[model samples]
Target: MISARNFLHFSRGVALAAAVCFFAATLAVAQTDALPSWNDTAPKQAIISFVEKVTKPDSADFVPEAERIAVFDNDGTLWVEHPIYTQLAFALDRVKSLAPQHPEWKETQPFKAVLEGDMKALAASGEKGLVELIMTTHAGMTTSDFQKIVIDWLASARDPKFKRPYTELVYQPMIELLAYLRANGFKTFIVSGGGVELMRPWAEKVYGIPPEQVVGSSIKTEFRMEDDTPTLFRLPEVNFIDDKAGKPVGINQQIGRRPIAAFGNSDGDLQMLQWTTMAGGPARLGVLIHHTDAAREYAYDRDTEFGRLDKALDAAAITGWTVVDMKADWKQVFKD
Candidate 1:
């Protein structure tokens, strides 16, 4: 009963609606692809399978939301840690800023080495000298003042190689993984060798991790009354080094429960991974982000100074840990 012209118009409207619906469905699928930066490789498949198994309510490997703890190493695991650690870079820069105050530092061995950019001399200065550098720059300030200093430094400091803010150097794929895990009812925590205060300032904004959820090395702090105000002053004293064996200790002290999944990049994280995945009651997930993409990011393992991956690399194979080859496994490195 319709006219020919009216029928043609109706057909056109139906075609347009179908096109819109198809486009929308395509977009939805694209948006839901959790780790778009990760290639469809063994590592990616392993991650998806593990997540599915644990998240599925009917599956035997299912973990309840309360017990879904995931711990991550900060430096080379989540962000770039090459040439030197971000915290160490901050300390070196601080030495230059404070050199004016201490005129004797110009002739001092370790301080002089840092000032002259003499890597050999700095290395010769040994652990004692390194401790001296950290103490001089990191101490003598209140907690609040130190936090402000760190915040200010992070805002201005740029990674020498990338020429971008250090925070921006964080891996896009890892960020996606973190989000994916959290979406699947996992509580993510940052367990790093970096100073707790150094990471707490920006971790929430950058990694979606809260300050209290961060566990790391700490310097001694003293409570004092400053001008009728209570303040906690940072001291030049070592509290704990959350690396290697200390990682497990830090995890226990901070998280109070054993994590079912752990992620790391270097030998320093081996103990944490072992504690998490090898404890072995049920299915567990351990992932190591192997930096193999020299073109996109730095490629160094087994002999790297910053993130030495010798022992852990060996352990991964024997323990069935997922070693993510950045070159082959990741579609991208940093986020745009």
Candidate 2:
């Protein structure tokens, strides 16, 4: 009962309306699916369940927005820490770059090992030798200078396996989890064993956690004025070590309030989980990221020297902490 022209226009309008409706539905699904990168497994469900209980008004586990503090370890928990800690890699590169300035490094046990790329010899250097490497490469510069050096190094630095910029190596699932928690009125902080200065420059851009919310191990610094500019000069001395027992102390000193949730991957984070979950004022959550994905990423637990997941892996059974099996729990490791 319509002209050909009228009928054609009407058909076009119908298609347009359908497209709009479809687009809206797709958007809604995306908005609701907070962790698309995560497999719809128990670990994903546990995270969602905890967030719901803590944020829901009628739930007994509901915590006020201010008290909903969540802490995360940076290295293995949030991003890749396999092969070696990213910071150590940076230090090794730095030792090489600075070799021309210090000729004695050619003969030094650790430095010589680093230059020769001898993993066994480097391991033999032990904790003292490792500390010496950290001090030699990390100190004797202003905080601003140190940050700039880190930023420059990160700009070109690529993971040995992925061959992608280190920043691009962050776990997509964890990034989604961070945004999900923040969207739910929970504050997030990165409590890492990595240097505070090293992370503060990039954490906000990389993880959405601002520099002020980053807490980590640090060296002693001296305030001095150079050419009328006030600067904090990093010294070759340890001020704090924010690992194991030190994590809780760092959190207490910096964050003040006890975190309601803690996420970590290694034994270094055991005390942090204990502090968050054991002090029973409210319902708390502890999560450990188990590196089980060998195909998509490196897999190491009991045997690895770096980012070893041993005691905490054992504790998760008794403490009831959610152990996220990376192979089974995460659908995607890195973002597209």
Candidate 3:
């Protein structure tokens, strides 16, 4: 019923509105800081500067999208690894859960230590006992079954100090950093000493990192046919421990290419950082998250049983790696 002139004017008005909305959205995105949780500190500036240099096509240090790889350690770097490692907590809980099936655990050295909540005894069990505990709790199931177990445990597991689910303890700044890197054409990968299967179940949901992008310690998995269906069964055998020196080996085997950026918290990530940043390259970034805030998060370094940061702390200073002081550099630790 409208005249052609009127209809044309109405269409133009709508187009103008759409254009204004689009411009506003673009402006908002451009103005938003990628890492809002991170304070405007030296570490944040360093991260942004490195990413910009590598991503800008006109920059001399520009790295192609295909070569833009960033690796992050999973424990204290991405999430909370305080009081104890998340995996260790899982193992301890698993020991208690399976204790009813194995009565001998009541008298077993490490198992008994775990059952009685004897911290001193558990520590005395050493790496060997820890390995034994991990094998027993993490193996003797199919890969799919193990994944379900991990998923289930993570769903209900709560940090003793924070009383929050373990997954909720992930660092907000790190999460933002991961997304920022990905947004800038970098493929982010989790290279951790935690069990690969254990992390694979929740990595995508929590960190937006896929299962294949995770490189971590793993137990032996054997292929077999179960009732006509092919299955990969986990075995109680140590395959690879992706910590310290093993990190580079795992990266080569899994990702096949070197990462230009690496992030970590503890000494376990020293070799990984060295491999990523020290490799002859255009512009590489290495960041160490120093847990310096005891109020918001647990702070521990050289003296801590888990996530010992001594060697890495010293190396960061010498190697020019940017160390992020959690208390000063991060405005918020965990996402609300």
The true-versus-predicted C-alpha distance at residue 118 of model 2, in Å, is 1.5
- How large is the C-alpha RMSD of every model relative to the true structure? 5.8, 6.1, 2.7
Candidate 1 pairs with clashing backbones: none
Model 2 alpha-carbon drift over 4 Å, by segment: 1-31
Model 1 misplaced regions, further than 4 Å: 1-31
> What digit string (tens of lDDT, one per residue) describes model 2 on residues 202-318?
999999999989999999999999899999999999999999999999999999999999999999999999999998766799999999889999889989888888998899999
> Which of 2 and 3 is ahead in lDDT?
2
lDDT of 3 by residue, 182-248 (tens): 9999999999999998898889999999999999999999999979999999999999999999999
Instruction: For each candidate, give its TM-score against the true structure.
Output: 0.91, 0.91, 0.93
lDDT of 2 at 103: 95
Model 1 earns a TM-score of: 0.91
TM-score of 3: 0.93
lDDT of 1 at 68: 96
Error of 2 at 115 (Å): 1.0
Residues 1-336 of candidate 1: C-alpha lDDT, one tens digit per residue:
989999999999999999999999899867788999999999999998999999999999999999999999999999999879999999999999988998999999899999999989999999999999999999999999999999999999999999999999999999999999998999999999989999999999999999998999999999999789999999999989999999999999989999999999999999999999987677899999999989999999998789999999999999999999999999999988
Better of 1 and 3 by lDDT: 1
